[model samples]
Every structure is written in C-alpha cells, then in structure tokens.
Target: MFSTGSDDVGVRKAFFGSLVFETVEKTNGATSITTGIDNPVPIVILFVVLTIVFTMMQIIYRGLKQRRDELLKMSGS
Candidate 1:
C-alpha cells in the first residue's frame, strides 16, 4: 500500500500530466446476470435462404408440370 504522487484524498497530477482522484466511498453493489438470444443473424439468413430456395423450386416444378401438360395435349391432338 505505497502511496505515490500526492494521494492524500484529493485530485493530483501525475508525471504524464494526467488527473488522478482518490477518495473514500461506499455503495451497495449492483450485479446482474442477463440472458438473451445470440447469433440471430445466421439463423435468420438460413431461414431466408431456405425460403428462397423452396420458392424457386416450387416455381420450377409448376413450370415443368405446365410444360408436360401442354406437350401431352399437343400429342393427343
């Protein structure tokens, strides 16, 4: 507990021209443990990609089905 540079319960300037304050104080400690959902960006991106892929797949499937029906009708006629 070596006190240095005018640490007698008041503000003082150090060698590098920095202000230092020393005081006696007390207060009730306030600590908390917080819980939250983390890394949400990747999950959201994954869902978005899945949605886009499924939508495109459905569009392609419907187009192919329509093309097949058209060909079938032409062949029958």
Candidate 2:
C-alpha cells in the first residue's frame, strides 16, 4: 500500500525523484544559455588587437610631439 505524505517512505521517494528531475531540467536550461557563448572568442581577439593598435598610435603621437618641440626650440620658435 502507498501513502501520499512524507510520513510514508514511498511519498518521500517520489518527492526525491521529482527533485532530481527538476535538477536535470535546470541543467539543460543552462546548456541552452551557453549556446551562443562560444562565438565571443573572435570578438575578444578583435578587442585586444584594437587596444594594441591604439596604444602604438598614442606612442607615435607622443614621439612626434617631442620631435616637433625640439625642432621649434632649435629654430627659436
């Protein structure tokens, strides 16, 4: 005979199985959440490349400014 409350062992077993099923459902939901997560590597690479390019550009600009300053000082500007 089966009873439908926690006082009965069978009901406790059923409730445990339901909890396990719910956990599997949540795991599958997480899998779908990451479906598009794999494509961002290229975007990350592009961001890093742009950062390096901008850093180099800033260094070049500073170097040109220093050279212009020296040239002005030599020409009495």
Question: Which candidate number maximizes lDDT?
Answer: 1
CA shift of 37, model 1, Å:
2.8
lDDT of 1 by residue, 16-68 (tens): 33333334323544322223333456557778999999999999999999999
Write down the TM-score of every candidate: 0.53, 0.50
Q: Model 2 off-target regions past 4 Å?
A: 1-37
Candidate 2 structure quality by residue, lDDT tens digits, 9-51 = 2212233232211111244443111112324556677789999
Q: Give Cα distance to truth, residue 52, candidate 1, Å.
A: 0.2
- The Cα local distance difference test for each model comes to 0.57, 0.51
Candidate 1 RMSD to the real structure: 17.4
Against the hidden true structure, what lDDT does model 1 obtain? 0.57
The C-alpha stretches of model 1 lying farther than 4 A from their native spots are: 1-36
